[model samples]
Target: MAEYKMTTPLTDEDVEKLKIGDIVYLSGTIYTARDAAHKRLVDLINEGKELPFDLKGSVIYFVGPTPPKPGEPIGSAGPTTSYRMDSYSPILIKHGQKGMIGKGKRSEEVKEACKKYKAVYFGATGGAGALIAKRIKKAEVIAYPELGPEAIRKLEVEDFPVTVVNDCYGGDLYEEGRKKWAKA
Candidate 1:
């Protein structure tokens, strides 16, 4: 129930304290990776090739942003639906990815991986592109630029707001939140 201020470096304790409905303004380093990047990463793993960056304790944001306006660090950046990358997530979780940022439902196996690995999934408000883009301080494409929107980019962010959709303990906000409205 604690309201965290913007720009806090969330610890394991801080992340663990967050629940489905709780809001947070995330800061610090986050890496962007989507379906194409994920596929490449997994392929690298299979080939025993080194990845572009260390996966440990990193947060992978599932986003493909629009081109930035003049002098802006990034453009309309927001989370995409998570289910598209469900098959790749469990592997990343097993490899030490601690947080995922996206929207919509995930597969049961991904949820199970979160429980087993002390990982979490966060949901950014869908369609809040302009508002979300303001939080990004800088953007650097680290891998797969050919994929364009699906490319992996490293972002330095400040006060990025999001809701806890899934936590390490098997709590799911979307499921519980929907049930309340569904019973109407």
Candidate 2:
């Protein structure tokens, strides 16, 4: 699969070029939201209330980072399990959210949303929180401070590595990988 370096606020053209298993090193801004935050986001969408951040062309990371150490921008910032947000992901994707960063398989609904909306699901390395935090240049709580670590944060990342797990064209790395390895 091809590898690409992309910055955030991705366009349709950017999403279109990716396929499952492609390595992508993303740079620029991405937002943080775990299950609690996702529920809030979907609630806002259903109520026609303005979201904290624009959904169009945005990448949301499924993470609730730890407290930052002295002089650092963020603490251990690894991906959370993606499936927990599956219930809310389609709504976000339908509203123009372009990418999601997390680990594990997504539901059929989420994959369908990616296919229908020209969005992608990216999988960051699990258990590599400290290593991943090195790529994050900045992080600040943008909403829902009461949720503590689960609060939404805006993050500036540079060369943050991820794999395209589900693509806009209906490719799924988890399925393909199982098949490929099983045959071997």
Candidate 3:
């Protein structure tokens, strides 16, 4: 119901202020990790190995961008289906990850983790890869390069648009919106 402009490495306070359905324009550093990258990250955690990037206050974007063209910082970068990362998300949240950016419904465990860990789930426009790519100012493969487009990339974004799909207070926009329209 509100709009917020946030810069990443989001804090507990930052995520606490958000609610489902709120619009957000996120700027600053975010990491991209698709399913393959997530599995590796989780595997590292389980092995007690140091991760490629610090997890504290981190926001992970679930995307596997296409190869860039002539002069772009990134190619078409859109959110991947969120459920694919569900199995790994709670573990990441437990380690101080404060936000996630992706599309589609998440599992109950993910939602609970968001509430328990003061994290938030953000939804990016599903088919707006080209438009979203314009918001990414810089991108560099930080880990798992062999995974190709599924590699973990550190990204600097500016005013990247998103919506708060699930918030720390147990709000879920997908369910709320569906219930609101179900009777119409």
Candidate 4:
């Protein structure tokens, strides 16, 4: 249950020290990619094609934000359910993706990938899109503009908040909380 202030392109050392239930205030860059974009990314990797963004030390947020209002960088940027990306996640992690931001439980395979690759799974507060958008200082669709909201966008964030749902050492906050309350 520690709170840390971290910057992205997070290193393996940075992710390894985090434990499930720890809170993180992340600053710096992150990229957005939903299920549609994820499939494309995996396909590129399998083909040995170059990706749009460097996967090394990158964090991907599972979100497709609404169009920004006047003078705003983004709008209603909320996390999508994580399971939809489960199939592509381990592949990305193996390629150097260090963290993810989304809601809901991750698949066991995702957990195993995090453990094997020294990555982490983070959960953002769902239904808090507008609030989350405030943390995003800039956003630009870097690829697949045809995918609309599902496009890969490079984002600059300051103090973006998240919780460690799954840690590299095999800790899972969701399962731990369930067991704790079950015993109470």
TM-score of each: 0.93, 0.98, 0.98, 0.98
Looking at candidate 3, the ten consecutive residues that score lowest on lDDT are 175-184
lDDT, model 2: 0.95
Number of clashing residue pairs, candidate 3: 0
lDDT of each: 0.86, 0.95, 0.95, 0.96
Cα lDDT of model 2 by residue, 88-177, tens digit: 999999999999999998999999999888999999999999999999999999999999999999999999999999999989999999
lDDT string for model 3 (1-184, tens) is 8999999889988998999999999999999999889999999999999999999999999999999997878999999999999999999999999999999999999999999999999999998999999999999998989999999999999999999999999899999999989975
Lowest summed lDDT across 10 adjacent residues in model 1 is found at: 1-10
| Model 4 misplaced regions, further than 4 Å | none
Kindly list the per-residue Cα lDDT of model 4 for residues 1-184, writing each as its tens digit. Answer: 9999999999989998899999999999999999999999999999999999999999999999998889888889999999999999999999999999999999999999999999999999999998999999999999999999999999999999999999999999999999988953
The better-scoring model by lDDT among 2 and 4 is: 4
**How many clashes in each candidate?**
0, 0, 0, 0
